[model samples]
Target: MDDSTLVASSKSGIEDRLSITAEFYTLNNVHANSAKYVLLFSSDPSSVIFFGLSPPPLINNNTLTLTSLALTTSFRFLGVWFSLSASSQFVLKQARSMVKDMAALLTLKKLLAQHVAYLYNAVLLSRLEFRLQTSLFFDSIVQSIIFPMFSIIKRKAGLASTTPLALLYLKIPFSIQHAFCRFLLGKKFLLILIFGNLPIMLFLIFKNLWVLRVVLLPST
Candidate 1:
């Protein structure tokens, strides 16, 4: 696919692409390098995307090499920052005064995602030769995709002093936004919404409470 097609596809949902990319990284050494190169390309927006071609600094060593895995994880980290930068722009469109705090939180998330991605990639690289099934496959996908997405959402919400609970608002797209807002005006709005989305709402509430605690206890 072309560059625009690839970027548009990324919006489709990174879950499937992450799984497929993980599989490729498992099978071919080239894919590992390609993943790193993709991170590099993401870093430099002006860099030309050489579709269907080998990326810079070819992977000449064994796929299981620690050096290879380290580079891959490092770039995966840079990828997280790249995602945060883009998401920050979106948040700014909504809330400009929060930019400084948003940048700080985004930096924190970038570091956290890096650590998590490094650990996950290390595990995958070590188990490259082992037989992987659907369960483990999905587990890996969740590790790679969901965790990073959560980190981004958490950081974005932090910008507004909103906490991760704000991610609940994000789960619903703009199309349903007005409806949710109208519903929230009802007397039992939180009660109804909580009951309707108990599991997620609870999780979000926990995150929100955590933010409140942090705000209330500054020295803690």
Candidate 2:
């Protein structure tokens, strides 16, 4: 079955809720029998879910419980990393490594300036597009990753590091990095969600934001 996450407000009823959920999904022929779940506490560790075995029906849970569930400080949900520690260095390090690896291909001698630019813009840079939508990238983080891609483009185009950055986008074949891709994409998504008028978005918008018509303006 596809991945799913269950959220509980407090320690109370966590066991019963999990058992009820597991049994319900298991009876429905979903892969809910595996007692595999990680706890990430945002505030007090004791304030969240209960620390105990799932149930006998969940086979894998028997060995997992010792009056407590496994607690982790960080875990990746889908492609984005979520952390209770509030440090993004791990995320940034991985992103930088990925960019560096992809940019290394730019050093190939066979690729023309346009070809280099095309590969960088189309393939390598597009990798970040999906991730940008999920996380808030600060300006420093943006620059840290963006500069490497630009540097590779500069090297491939026989330009020095000190060369005018504007020239790369204007004169050179390389396109400027869409550092605002995340914000632009988010705007587009919100526009669609707002104006598309799907039932769910409509319900949420009207329910929570009916009094706040200012959001209907250009770009709230």
Best by TM-score: 2
What's the TM-score of each model vs. the native?
0.16, 0.59
TM-score of decoy 1: 0.16
lDDT of each: 0.30, 0.54
Superpose all Cα atoms of candidate 1 onto the true structure and report the RMSD in Å to 1 decimal: 22.4
Per-residue lDDT over 111-131 for candidate 1, one digit per residue giving the tens place of the 0 to 100 score = 543443343234322232121
Could you list the CA RMSD of all candidates, in the order they appear?
A: 22.4, 11.3
Stretches > 4 Å off in candidate 2: 1-4, 12-14, 20-37, 46-72, 134-140, 180-220
Off by over 4 Å in 1: 1-136, 139-141, 159-170, 173-220
* Candidate 2, backbone clash total: 0
> Which predicted model would earn the best lDDT?
2
Score candidate 1 by lDDT. 0.30
Check candidate 2 and list the clashing pairs: none
**How many Å off is the CA of 197 in candidate 1?**
42
